[model samples]
Target chain A: MHIPFDQLKAEFKRVLLKLNFTHERADFCAQIFAENSRDGVYTHGLNRFPAFVQHIKNGLINIDAQPTLINNLGAIEQWDGNLAPGILNASFCMDRAITLAEQNGIGCVAIKNTNHWMHGGTYGWQAADAGFIGICITNSIANMVPWGGSTNALGNNPLIIALPRADGHVVLDMAISQYSKGKVLQYQSFEDELPFVGGYDGDGNLTKDPNAIIESKRLLPIGLWKGSALSMVLDMLVSALSLGKTVKQITDQGNESSASQVFIAIKPFNA
Target chain B: MHIPFDQLKAEFKRVLLKLNFTHERADFCAQIFAENSRDGVYTHGLNRFPAFVQHIKNGLINIDAQPTLINNLGAIEQWDGNLAPGILNASFCMDRAITLAEQNGIGCVAIKNTNHWMHGGTYGWQAADAGFIGICITNSIANMVPWGGSTNALGNNPLIIALPRADGHVVLDMAISQYSKGKVLQYQSFEDELPFVGGYDGDGNLTKDPNAIIESKRLLPIGLWKGSALSMVLDMLVSALSLGKTVKQITDQGNESSASQVFIAIKPFNA
Candidate 1:
């Protein structure tokens, strides 16, 4: 139950190698998964490992694919993720953003057709570790209802902001929704109510009942209308900037792949 | 109650000139105030004009002082607001940011010692109107309690994001708090409870009673811990980037006069 970090990472790498992953990619990804768990994000760490493997086996992830430059706009660059592993694509993009920032004081990179980055904060940490202010956002499948709407029309998009500090990096990574579907399902499994109103029920009343919300599939956006509007704008930002699929497009395809994402790095004045 | 836009602007300009504002500055400020009202943001429009005048009269705003460049980091620039009008300073910073973005594909400007820009959305619209993506944030005096803390420690900092669209520009302007103090005061004035939980009562229980929340001074941040963390990081960002006052410092100063703000503009690929 308390495996050592190195052992966990080695196990992940071994499994990836068995699946024909190159030595470098396997080790890099294994370290990320291990770090995610060590960092207490079990949901995206070992717990999600099996799903990730399954997706790869189903050809949803192209292990050998690499992100290719779409266009260069001075300090901003657009990339096509080529359906590659999200971790690698995101990391590569952030590195590019940082390089651009080093040249221009601010850099932005938008990537399209990317897979799910297991932990969005990883890129934020990457930039902060490099002594730059970092911001990133990603759009997902429509999983939330728009404000004043009865049907799902928005993604509970995640946003990340990181500021490097002398003591410790200050990072704020949040999803627009009050709670993720995984969280709701966890509460339901424990037969416990949410501590706060998580979503709307079938009758359209705000509720803490996980089952009701899960059944209705109407997760509440954080701050109600404020979060709804925020989610919509973020979705627009990512998709438009990347010129990629929108939430509706992703949902219509019956999968959550080909997501659009943006990464930005700003050289702090001190830097 | 139904004054024409021109009449309202003229009246504001006349009053501002009486307070010794130059004709150009007075006209610009009055136009912003009138546009806020015309755009249905009464809180920051005519309703706030008298307070703006009072601040000027009290020497809180320096009409003659202009923002001066502190340093230019290529695509990013830092400025000292010289305790000038927030609206003018913010507009000037955004314009500079836009110009930088035009040259480098992205740009950022940070200003310190600025007053409150009446409506934060005004800057967002300014960028969108120029066919660019805009993002801005500003710190305020401490007003909301941090997560897991009973005392006031965080500012209800506002964030604005805007994207240009053919039909209409999509803009999101939101404070970290679920309900702003102004909104709560409005509800209290009408003897009406908030439509949802706005803040904590004196006993530390979430409540919709505006009077109790006001008395307790425990406004709830959006998404509870999430928003609290966001506000803290935003405060850290603006202050760290500008080397200006934090929420604690602003609160200690007994007035929200020398606030720090950041404006960012990104050139869209199509642009």
Candidate 2:
């Protein structure tokens, strides 16, 4: 249960290479996955690896594909992820953004056809480590009901804002959902009821029971209507900026592939 | 009680002139105060005007002062607000940022020694209407306790993000607090319990009583510890970017003047 970090990364790299990933792609992605676990983000680390591998096997992720730029408008660039692994594609895009910012003070990259990047904080940390202020967002499959609505129709899309500091890079990464589905699953795994009402029950009453919430699939968005509006706005921004599929379109695809994401890097003036 | 907008603005204008404000300054400040109320932010508009006037009278806000540029590095500029009214200083800074973005792809302006911007969304809408993505944030007097700390040591600092949209111009203006102090006062006026647990009682148990919360000054930050961390990180970013006062320093001020803020504008690719 507590494998060494290096072993975990090596295993991921082995699997990815066996699946035909290029040497560079397997090494970079496997390192990120291992780092997520070592840094205590279990949901996106070891636990997520199985689901990630499954997605690739199911053709939701294309191991050999990479992000390719499609449009360039001043400091903004649009790219197609080519259904690539989200972690690799995200890193590639942020690198591009950083390069552009180094030349133009600020840069933005929007990509479509991305898979889940796992923990969003990784990208923020990457940018901060590069001496840039970074903001990143991604639109996911709808697992949350819009506020004031009883149906599931919104994504608990995460937002990350990081500022480079001499001390630990200040990073704020949060999902619009009060409790993400992974968090609920974690609580259920521990056989613990959530301390607060995480979502609604099948009968439509707020409930703390993690199992009931997972069963009902009525995850509560953060701050009710506030988070719903935020989710919609973030979705619109990522989709519009990337000129890619919206959440509605992503869900209609019947699989959570080809999602859209946006990454921005602002070169710190002082840096 | 429904005052004509012009009459309300003119009355404010009259007071600022009496206080020796320049003609342009008085009119600019008065117009924003009136527009805030018209846009349904009465808490920061008419209701707060008396206190704002009192601050000037008490010499808390420096009526004759204006922001002076401290540094300009690439597209980022830093200003010292010279203890001016937050609304005036913030508008000017955002305007400067817009000018920078017009030249470059993005621009940032961070200000120190400012007072509170009555409505953060006002500046956000300003940038969105200019067809750019806008973001702004401000640190406040400490009013919320940090996570795991019973005493207040964090500002319920507001963060605003707006994207120019074809419809509605998606703007999110939110404080880290679950319910802002002004909102609690509104609930108290109606003799109503907060619909949710807005803060902890004297004994640190969650409660809905607006009176108790206001008395305690122990407002709950949104998402419990999540917002607390966010507010802290935001304060750090503002302080670092402007090389200005931190929340700790602002709290040490006898009253809530001389706060710091940051504004950023990024040109959309399409434009």
Candidate 3:
């Protein structure tokens, strides 16, 4: 229950190596997973590790692939992630964005075919560490219903904004939904009601019962209609910029693989 | 109450001409003001026209001043607005940004010493009309409190995002506050409580009473803490990018003149 951070990372690395991950890939992915757990994001860390491994074994993620350049538009670049691990693809895209920003004051990089980049804040922190303003967004399998709709038709896409400061970086990571599916599951495990309405109940009314929301599979978006519109636009932005799969397309594929993402970096004026 | 659009534009043009505005300047400003009224944003259109005249009469607006180029860094440019009316300065900046974006795939223009641009969506629509993605933000006088702080130390900055579409452009214009001061005032005039809590009462408790919130002058931010952080960052972003005055400095000057703003435009991939 209280394994040391190093031990946890070692175990993860060992498992990935057995799954045919290269040494460098195993080490890098293991470090990220360890950091996620250390940062208290166990949902995307240890808890999701088994599912991640299963996905790889199920041929949903291609571990040996690398992102390939799709287009170069001066300060903006587009890439095909080639279904690589999300962490690696996101990290590489942010690095490229930072480099472009250094050259042009601002840079945008969009990638398609990436996996779920666990802990979206990681790349935001990466850019802040490099002394730049970072903004990123990613789509996922549809788990949220569009405003006024009864069925799931939208993803609870997350947006991240990070600003570098001399003392500490300010990073804001938020999902468009009021509460994520992981959070609902957490509350369900405790048999607790949400403090505020998180989604609709069976009768199509707003409710605080996590069980009702989970059963309905209709997580409420932040600010209701506002969040719905924002999510729709963000989905368009990422997909159009990357020339990649949209949420509808990803949902139809029956897996969360090959998601689209966008990363942007701006070199601060003072920097 | 039901004046024709052309009549309203003509009235505005006549008044602006009498206030020493050049024919071209008066015509441009009058058209935007008329469009604002036609688009149902009467608060910034006809309802605000008398205040605009008063500002001009008080010499708070420099009728003849034009924005001057400050610096250009390839895809990014900076300008000194010379305390010109915000509409002209914002329009000029967006035009420059669109031009840069067309040449380099993306462009950013930051300006200092501009006034209020009235409805911020004007610039967003401007870019969308040009078939590009537009993003714009502006800092204003402090009106909202920061999260965890009791005093008003942040501006309810407005952000605009516009995407060009074949059928119709999608545009979102939002202020960081849950309800703008104008909206609160309107509710007060109607003797109605806000549909949702807008801000705090004198005792620092959240309330839906428009009168109490107006008296307290403690406008609650959108999403509470989330919007506060966003407003702070946006203020920093506009001021830092323009190398201009922050909200604190602007408030200290005792008027909302000489504000800072930024406009960004990106060429859509297909474009």
Question: Which candidate leads the pack in lDDT?
Answer: 1
Report the poorest 10 consecutive residues by lDDT, candidate 3 chain A.
A221-230
Docking class of 3: medium
> For every candidate, what share of the true interface contacts is present?
0.68, 0.26, 0.36
DockQ of candidates 1 onward, in order?
A: 0.77, 0.42, 0.53
Best by TM-score: 1
The residue-level lDDT of candidate 3 at B124 comes to 94
Q: Which residue ranges in model 1 land beyond 4 Å of their true spot? A: A188-192, A201-205, A209-215
TM-score for predicted model 1 compared with the true structure: 0.97
Comparing 2 and 3 by DockQ, which wins? 3
Model 2 accuracy (lDDT, Cα): 0.86
Off by over 4 Å in 2: none
lDDT of model 2 at position A159: 87
DockQ of 3: 0.53
In model 2 chain B, the worst 10-residue window by lDDT is B221-230
For candidate 1, write residues A47-166 as lDDT tens digits: 889988988999888999999999897999999999998999999999999999999888999999998998889999999999999999999988889889999889998999999988
Judging by DockQ, tell me the better candidate of 1 and 2.
1
Give the B-chain TM-score of model 1. Answer: 0.97
- What is the model-wide C-alpha lDDT for candidate 3? 0.88
What lDDT score belongs to each candidate, Candidate 1 first?
0.91, 0.86, 0.88
Off by over 4 Å in 3: A190-192
> Best candidate, DockQ-wise?
1
Q: Estimate each model's TM-score.
A: 0.97, 0.95, 0.94
